[model samples]
Target: ICNTVYRRIPLRGVCTKCGGNLTLTVHERSIKKYLEISKMLTEKYDLPGYARQRIKLVEKSIESLFTNDKVKVTKLSDFL
Candidate 1:
């Protein structure tokens, strides 16, 4: 009996009914694109060449998820 709000479900529309910190948009293209960008950025910063940059990259990616203005989507595919 997981409440949709607590379950990390994609946002059903533009407004967040819960008014929580993270607002997810229910759109596949947006979510997929975010994942792809996160992955590519992760790989770039996680490489041996950028050993010191791993932390930076990871932080950036996480922040991007919340701060990205291009699209709003929280990755809930793991649950799907």
Candidate 2:
């Protein structure tokens, strides 16, 4: 997916809006693929403390990467 996106990118190195969205979706899916299974296995197998900690770190990193950083505000009257 990334390779395809890279090829489609312009020489200036900026991806088109579509390409950027595709790349983000691909990355998000791939990152989340094994997360649940990894945590389940870690618990089932009684993995070492470090291994568990590493998985937690990865989860945090993934969350940060995929989460929207922007904050949106609405007028208080809108809720009335």
- Over 4 Å off, model 1: 1-25, 47-80
Count of backbone collisions in candidate 2:
0
lDDT of 1 by residue, 1-80 (tens): 22235445455542255544544456555555765675576687765656447555755665666675977666889569
lDDT scores in order: 0.57, 0.75
Per-residue lDDT of candidate 2, residues 1-80 (tens digit): 23444535465444554444343235787768799889999999999999999999999999988787796567999999
Q: Give the Å shift of residue 77 in candidate 2.
A: 11
lDDT, model 2: 0.75
Off by over 4 Å in 2: 1-27, 71-80
lDDT of 1 at 69: 95
Against the correct fold, how does model 2 do in TM-score?
0.56
Error of 1 at 63 (Å): 22
